[model samples]
Target chain A: MAISVDYVVRETATNLRRNLLMTTAAILTVAVSLSLVGAALLLRQGVTRATLQWQGGVELSIFLNPDIAATQRDAIKTQLDAMPEVRRVAYVDQEAAYAEFKQMFANSPDMVESVSAKDLPPSFRVVPRQPELTEIVGQRFNKREGVKEVVYAEDMVETLINFTDFLQNVIFAVAGVLLLSAALLILNTIRMAIFARRREVAVMKLVGATNWFIRVPFMLEGMVQGLVGAAASFLMLVVSRGLIASALEGNHLIEQFVVSSADVMGTGLFILAMGALVGGAGSALAVSRFLDV
Target chain B: MTATRPAPTERDHWRRQLLLTLVAVAGGIVSLRLMALSVARERDVYLVIMADGSRVRSASYLVTLWPAAVALAAAFGVFASLVVHTYRVARFTFRSDIEPSPTGELP
Candidate 1:
């Protein structure tokens, strides 16, 4: 028997309205799940951006002994600069190093009085081809004759990266579980709805309704629910982002870690598409089990 | 043929079993998260560097809300599964009560 497309659409609309609460629950579940996933992505992006910025400013400092001869210092500088990883090397003399220190602590007369040109360590300020190689370059320079100490900002960089990585892993794990819960909730909701309408479905089957005719309406309803959920989740994300920005505006740490608008929009769209796919598939599976027309 | 009704004792027993399971699961999850957090707090390292370059070290770790979220998800999953299982059992019992007996017998 032939089924009318108009009838299917009307039936789907009626069912959607009749089970408004269930539909709403399904939509909200999807929205919350997607929002979590979206937030995780945004956080990962922020971490990547901050890491890049920090990497760009990384430098290696190679300190020298005051007794090192000028000719020996020149030779060491030449050797350091010749390395493939070395981008540029500037030799800082005792007087120049002292002057720079004095200028930095100009406001503190006590600090300036305690240190003189002779007391200040003259060194070679080394820039690397890659920020990550700063530590390696510093260690190599320290091992060379006439080199007293090496400071490559290794601890700070490692701490930041490890912290971000740990946070990102936690976010991913949480998001994964939330998404699984949403999927299970959606499947169960649809199953219950189908069970409630079993008699109506039996009557339709007796009337010669085809499987596709019955399934299309439920799929459409699921798609509508998913799209609405996505829209709500996106709005929530935008509001939360705004609130966080305002709260952290004056905070030095977070000022450099703001999520960009473009990333938010892109993530929102991706989540919306994902929600639709999951919802539609979940509903189809539920309907297929009981409505085997 | 008349349908057979479930005994009151059987119904009561099922409900009690479900309730116990829910409580046990919830308590177990709470205890697990608490243990993890307590262990983590003890090993945490906190360092304070003064303006004069002097450093002080104490116990601290960058604890955030992420762990709580994971614990919540696990709890939710346990609750959801319990609910689904209870519903299925109830539905089967209800269906059995309504269906005519194949032997044409009543109890």
Candidate 2:
């Protein structure tokens, strides 16, 4: 007899009800797994935003000597600006630089009251087309005869990148362990289901039921369990994402870190698929030995 | 002389216990995964750095919990199947003396 889809569906439903606790366990497994995956994605997004913000702030500072000639200063600016890596170079004349210093030291008026514009060195605030090119521009300016010092914010960028990398590795490692544990757990649950139905299986064998016929229903039951678990996980991820985004928005530093709606939905679907596959595979494997012997 | 046979009830009881154990393990794994994910979120910056230095910020967008969840679930299903099948074979063979009719011989 050809097995109807309705028949398979009914059998799966009945099995689910009969093994309610196991079914629940399977679903929970899927939910937890999916949640971890979702959280990891969100964490990555936050790091990306922070890095981009930092990179945007990178600039080359060229400090000029106190004795540099006006004509030489202008020439240096023109040379630096001509480089393809150089996006823009604004010269901060002695007067302007001195005003900035005074403003910066405004909290202590006495400290800057005697200082004059000539005492403050002229400099160029050089913006680069790319953050990575900051080093190149800084090095070039450092070799110039009239430049006193060259500073590029390379240390800050490197530190941020290293820190982010360490975090990703840790997350991935934890995710791996969770996945291993989940598999083992599902394995045990399906084993129990098979054990409970051993008599039924023996009877089917007695009646000459094919191995495939006996295994299909249990496999279907597992798939259903996984699907349910994935659904639950998806819902939880959505709620958690909203809560996290709200909390992050309150912090100005992390306000840009938000998990979009589309991401949540996409992740949910992926989790559901995973749950079903795991459940089905677990059930099938658990029952295989019994069928063979 | 009559041969004393082992009871089917004994096998059934043992099988039930095994299934319960499996369910407990699966539940524990699920709980652990949830906890891990929560912890991971708090350390997002570090995770990005590890994924790719230049693209650390973008790494979060690429990472997803779905693959791990699905992988775990699939692994569990296979484990369950293996455990159940193994138990059945062992139980049947061990108690064959109680069942006068061989499994294949029964109608």
Candidate 3:
């Protein structure tokens, strides 16, 4: 028997309307889980932006004794410049160091007044050819003659990054659990639909209705649930975009701590796609099982 | 040795399983793309030059890492989903003898 599109549409509608509570539960679960996913994506971007600024602040700093001989400073500079691991080396003379000190403590006039050009140490700001080799290379000059101490300025950023990684993992875990719940909810809704319409389904099968005929409407139901949940999540993200930007007002000079409109929309698109695929897949599986055509 | 032909019910089960597997693979690919985009952001290098001649650079692995790892992960996701779906289909008790019932819609 040729099943009309109208019949299928009506059946799907009836199935959805009949199971209002179950459908709502499924949708809300999907929305919550997807919202977490959206939040996680935004968090990652915020961390990336903030880290970029932190990373821009310093690489490896080698401070010299404030009273080090000019010859000693030059020797250290020359040695650093020649190393194959070193990408570039720049010397920070006393006057330049003083200027930076003033800028860094610009808010505190008393602090700036207490230190002078002579008190600040001349240093070499070294960029490594390979980032991974930074610690090992910095470790080389720990107790050397002219060097007072080598500072891995990026350590502060590294700690924050590790924290961000841990946080993202936690968010993903929560989202994973919610996603599983959403899947089970979808499965239950479909099963209930099958149970509710078993009489009609049996009559349709007896009248030679193919499995595809019985299955299409149910698969459509699953897709709709996934999509609506995803759409709800997409809207949530859209509404909440730039939350971090506002929260972190007037931050680092790099100003890269932004979650652009594109990021939200892109993540929204992903949630939508996932909703459709997972939504249909679950119902398809459930429908096929009970179809028995 | 004479091989026995598979029953029609078994063939129908295979058809349904194939459809579900296709859906799983599609879901896997989409998820993988999102993950790759996230990992690839690490390639951007942020640079800062102070009032002094000293320069600071971030994300040093900009040139030599991450992309390969992301690609490997994508490959793994694709293969894993297919294998997992196959396992589920083989082991699950989705028999055709169950009662005729059909409901449509996700969620």
Each model's lDDT comes to 0.64, 0.62, 0.63
- Docking quality (DockQ) for each candidate: 0.05, 0.04, 0.04
> lDDT score, residue B33, model 3?
42
Tens digit of per-residue lDDT, candidate 1, span B1-102: 999997544335245433534453353335234323433442243332222334333422335334434444554554455455445544443344432222
Off by over 4 Å in 3: A1-7, A17-22, A63-72, A75-122, A126-151, A242-258, B1-107
Candidate 3 accuracy as lDDT: 0.63
- Candidate 1 per-residue lDDT, tens place, A208-273, comes to 888877788888888777778888888877887788779878865455566888888998998888
Listed per prediction, chain B TM-scores read: 0.42, 0.35, 0.33
Q: Is candidate 1 or 2 superior in TM-score?
A: 1
Per-model TM values vs. the true structure: 0.61, 0.60, 0.56
Across residues B32-107, which tens digit of lDDT does each residue of candidate 3 receive?
3443343345434443333333544444443423443443454345345544544443344343344443442122
lDDT of 2 by residue, A147-246 (tens): 7777565553454355445544544444444444455556657766777777777787777877877788888988877778778878888898788678
- Cα deviation of A48, candidate 3, in Å: 3.1
Q: After superposition, how far is residue A190 of candidate 3 from its true place, in Å?
A: 2.4
Off by over 4 Å in 1: A1-8, A62-72, A76-123, A128-155, A206-210, B1-107
Ranking by DockQ: 1, 2, 3
